[model samples]
Target chain A: SQKIEQNSEALNIQEGKTATLTCNYTNYSPAYLQWYRQDPGRGPVFLLLIRENEKEKRKERLKVTFDTTLKQSLFHITASQPADSATYLCALDVRYGQNFVFGPGTRLSVLP
Target chain B: EAGVTQFPSHSVIEKGQTVTLRCDPISGHDNLYWYRRVMGKEIKFLLHFVKESKQDESGMPNNRFLAERTGGTYSTLKVQPAELEDSGVYFCASSQDTGSTDGYTFGSGTRLTVV
Candidate 1:
């Protein structure tokens, strides 16, 4: 069986600091991984997607890095703000399948 | 463009009652998906709809749940004789079928509370 894991605990950081979150998986090889941001009482919003062959991807202040050998990915948000406080989820695509498996997610709080 | 939209933002039903949740995907998006998150658990995939056809329903919990996408536009998921375990938040997402790189746009979701 395949399993995805996030930090599980909440992370609190000061405003304007960089926040890093991790996602790790085991047993299955995925072609691509994605990150999403979800606020309380709302659905997730897509953030970034990185393929297995890619080492790093960035969009504005958001950055994602994928390491196939370690089966881990790291998501980073620079100069974080209070609005960035939310739960971040990581998802992996099941090979040859249209369904995606997601981790439990890590909650991030940026405080001034 | 408008993002995906779901009806009945919140619902409370008793066991053995039937509830139907609707989702309207973005315009021109050919791929739609259904996912749910139970209390204290990760979000899990329930099914996928490629137009009007069910491409993958491997994650559906049991026969009590049925999802339909008619005319390849809006989708409906019904839970028959809903149980207490069916309480959770259901989300709908859609993406353009321009290969695999495009990410999905998700709806606000419907929260189902079964008592």
Candidate 2:
């Protein structure tokens, strides 16, 4: 069976600092990996997606790095703001399947 | 453009009852997906519909759940004789194109509490 894991503990950092989150998976070779931001009482909002062949992807202050060799992906949010506090989720597209498997997600809090 | 929308933002039902959840995907989106997240658990995929056809339903837990996408515009998920473990938040998402790299737009979600 395939499994995805993220930092279970909530990450707290000061505003304007860089926040790094990790996502690791086992027993699956995904075609693409994606990251999403979810706030309390709301659905997840997509952030970035990186293919297995791609090394890194960026959007605004967010950067995502995919290392297929280690079966891990790293998501970074630079100059984090108080408004950036939320749960970050990592999802992977199952090759040839319609469903995407998601990790438990890591909660981030940026204090001003 | 409007994002995906789900009806009855919150629902409370008794065990063994039937509940139906509705999702209206963004207009012109060809791919619609259903996902659920239980308390303290990851969001898990339930099913996918592509233009009124069920592309994949492998994530459906059991025979008590049924999902339909009529005319490929809106979708419905019905759970009959819901169990205690069915309490969770259900989300609906859609993408404009199947092959594009664009991210999906998700609805606010419907929180189902099975008491």
User: Judged by DockQ cut-offs, is candidate 2 incorrect, acceptable, medium or high?
Assistant: medium
TM-score, candidate 1, first chain: 0.95
Give one digit per residue, the lDDT tens place, for model 1 in A29-88. 988999999998989998999998899999999999999999999999999999999999
Residues forming the 10-long window of minimal summed lDDT in candidate 1 chain B: B95-104
The residue ranges of model 1 lying beyond 4 angstroms of the native Cα positions read none
| TM-score of the second chain, cand. 2 | 0.97
When only the first chain is scored, the TM-scores of the models are 0.95, 0.96
- Model 1 reaches an interface RMSD of 2.1
In the range A1-112, model 2's lDDT, one tens digit per residue, is 7799996659999999999999999998989998999999999999998999999999999999999999999999999999999999999987433678899999999999
Q: Which 10-residue window in model 2 chain B sums to the lowest lDDT?
A: B96-105
Best by DockQ: 2
lDDT of 2 at B74: 95
lDDT digits (tens) for residues B25-100 of candidate 2: 9999989999999998889999989989998898899999999998989999999999999999999999877634
